[model samples]
Target: MGIFLTILKILGIVLASIVGLLLLIILLVLFVPVTYKVSGEYGDKIGGRVKVGWLFASATGNIKKTDDGMDGIAKLKVFGISIKKIRLMGHDDTEDKHKVKPKKEKKNKKSGTGKAPDERTETGNSQMSDLENDLVNSPVNGLKNNTGAADTTGINGNVRVGETGGKADSINGNESFDIDGESDINKEIDRIFGTGDETPEEDKTADENSGKTADEDVNKTADEDSEKEKVGIIEKLRLKALKILEKISGTKDKVLDKKDTLIRKKDHFIEFLDKPYTKNTIARGKKLLKKVFKNLLPRKGNANVLFGLKTPEKTGAMLGKVCMFYPLYHKWLHITPEFYEKKIEADLWFKGRIFIGSMAIPALFLVLSKDFKRTRNLAKKI
Candidate 1:
């Protein structure tokens, strides 16, 4: 009975400890601010590192473009000690991809299961000798083996070079070897022509078609001229005048439409300026914008920048627009915009931090503002 009671007490203590640990973790997650820092440079590509830590753990990673998809690596640390690493964005393929491969060692020809150099040469020489022997035993090569000069007088066709007036005789049809400069070229040309006519048939056909095609073209041109003669000068003049009048009338109608549209736009803009809501709306927007910046934008920040636009007038106009936001950002933002040059070059570094928990009340106030609600409703009506 006493052992049972003691076991129960131990179990109760364990349960209470687990519950206390859970509560402590929940409180830490709710109250502890998760801090983050981001820093990088910008040129042709955008690259940066983001570090986020809550309580004791943090992650830092860079995401960039890749051939297949996004490629990134991150390190996770616990209590300031690296506990794990993310490879190729959570893939196991490691840094070995960039490592140089060791070259393969060339094997010795005399190694195990391979023939030595002397034996290999002996085998190659024996093979060549055997091939020569086989060729000598053949009937065709027997004559060459027994005689130095080749026998030309055979059954297929006799060149009869011993009797052809010091010239090779034609073999099989009119084919023969060129012993001298004047070969069977004339006979070959005659065979290709296959006729005794001075001019070839192909040239005769081409000449025949040439005159016929030229005559047909001239006839077509004459027919076109006769057809054009059927139309009177008065009819052509009337058609050209009609086309010109149509183009002029179309341009005049476009001009009148543009003038009417401009007049309507001018009158509408003037009426909008005279309304009382315009001034109220502008003032309300400025007030709301100030509140939003105070809540969302970090007041403490630093940046270095060089920027430009296409033209000097455009640069000045954009500069004024940028100043409407937190005016102090100009001090840290060493902004030099091109006034005369027309080129794009950017060198930028920005660093800032914002507390997510601190913006709660200001966000609520901005959302519940009477003017913001009225403005949204007015926009819907418009």
Candidate 2:
């Protein structure tokens, strides 16, 4: 009997220690801070850091763009000891800078009055008409002079006048007097009006070269326009992708805000639980507990629980009712009892028996027993 009592005392101490350790772990998990800091550009620059913990902790990295490339560093620590460290370096293409020339303004020619110059024909009709009149009047004047010379020559022919008479007679004998005059007039007309004939080979070649150059210029302009259109399309796609990313980031920020609100609410509830109990505190606790449980538990026909435990006076009775009526409790006990109003006595042989039975017993069994794999296989079969 003495040995048995000693064993029970030792077991009680071990269970109490385990319960304290578990509570400490739970407190640490609930209270430890996890912080993050992010600052930098999206594409041209980027950097961030994240830290989790109070004592046994972990931290993460930062990366940023430089003039030449990318550089970064990351570190991990456990129990104030560096467990892992990493460094990163990379390169990216740099932007190109180009010199741009300013455009020159075109100058418009102006007349003496300062208005733009009027269009004028380079070949004047008045000058051409004057040239035609001179051509017509000169033929008549040459004919009159020839006839007068003929009359003089005839008069000299009768007298046999001198060397001048001899030259005039020789001109009349060698050629028809009218033929020479007509030949001179034809030559003058030909000089004034060019012959309607085929163009020269040099002029034709020059025209063909000009046409080819114009076609080449048109093709080059078309190619440049196509390239510009392609670039514009690429820019539009890039902008669209950026817009989508912005929308996703906005949604992520909204979710984070909601999560932060929930975390704050949890912290408030924990603080409230640490305060002394009173009528107002109990009422507020009831409300907070109902809200939390409503969120955690499934609702019945769109309605959460409308009732709560009134105070510590009724706590035992409420727990008893829950154990009696709750489906989970009935399943665990594998039995149902008739309704009754009798007081039920509950007793524990050890001080930490509740914690040992609920947590340590199952945990120790899993760690020590070799039946975990068999149990897992059986669960899978089920």
Candidate 3:
């Protein structure tokens, strides 16, 4: 009975200890400051607004109570970390109210003369030449000053103006009128020559237009005549060759313009050559060598002959003798620069070959032993 009582006391103590430990941990957690990240996922329904203080995390005080009673504000210090939530914070006033008016485009005056616009020209009608005056004074007769020719336009035939004689004027089967002083002389001329003025301004304009049209026609005829003078095939070829030669000359000039840059290319080449290699440089070097050797090999011819000509047994033996001393050509292109005291990094100061040599001693020794074993077998066979 005493043993049972002692066992019950021990169990009680264990339980109490566990409970005390749990309480302690909770108290410690409550006092310590902690950071929490609260994020929202894509939801079906719209959620209420969440507002924080200056930073969305620190001292956040949200007023969830919007226009409704369900809205509530929360001022939180999550694990001693000051954070608050402010709901009911509405949208911002971000739009501009005052609108700017667009500028109106000014209209340009018509190009042709229409009723001779009332522009105050210092040069008046008196200053105009006789022809201009005649054109202006001539009866409107349904024709603008600039509107080319008025005569020879109608269907019936020529008719005398102010005299009322024979049939009306006509041109291209269309009936027209006499714009000029349609005297008997004009009617006779029309009957004999089949030509009459339906409009005076139009007649004068016709003369002017005919003069311009004749000049343009003459120019077009000259151009057509020149084109008729055809060149032979050899001449055409010569012209094309000349053009090609001119293009080559232009390219040569451009190259000359950039001569200074090409002269300084060596400096940049040296800079690239001196740059140190990173961890992947050895692999990249092997790839470059492979590509170069691949290109050097014959493409359209036999590969065995191409490679065999360059490396016979004599060359291999020579290379082997060199390898005996240096093991291999694991250089930074074998033209590695020596850097004694140039304030460079300590790791890259030594030649790449030396570094490779130091690292590869064990591997090289293994390879050399293997080679020696092969050499012994060959000697025994001989």
- Which residue pairs does candidate 2 place in steric collision? none
What TM-score would you give candidate 3 relative to the actual structure? 0.17
Ranking by TM-score: 1, 2, 3
Instruction: Supply the TM-score for candidate 1.
Output: 0.36
Per-residue CA lDDT of model 1 for 1-382, tens digit only, reads: 9999999999999999999999887666545666666666565665567787887888888766555555677889999899887764524455578779999999868648788899999999999999988765543321222222333543355543321225544545466553432224334656887647656787889999998999999999999988787766768899999999999999999999999998977776676555566556667566756754654554444566556776788889987887787475765566667777665544444344444434444455655767556555655543
Identify the candidate with maximal lDDT: 1
Better of 1 and 3 by TM-score: 1
What are the TM-scores, per candidate, against the unseen true structure? Answer: 0.36, 0.23, 0.17
* Candidate 1 runs further than 4 Å off: 1-5, 44-46, 63-72, 87-299, 326-334, 343-382
Worst 10 residues of 2 by lDDT: 346-355
User: Higher TM-score: candidate 2 or 3?
Assistant: 2
Q: lDDT tens string, model 2, 61-88?
A: 6676666667776788888788897775
lDDT at residue 366 of model 3 (Cα atoms): 40
Global CA lDDT of candidate 1, please?
A: 0.65
Evaluate all candidate structures by whole-model CA lDDT and list the values in order.
Answer: 0.65, 0.52, 0.46
Give the poorly placed runs of model 2, Cα more than 4 Å off: 41-46, 87-382
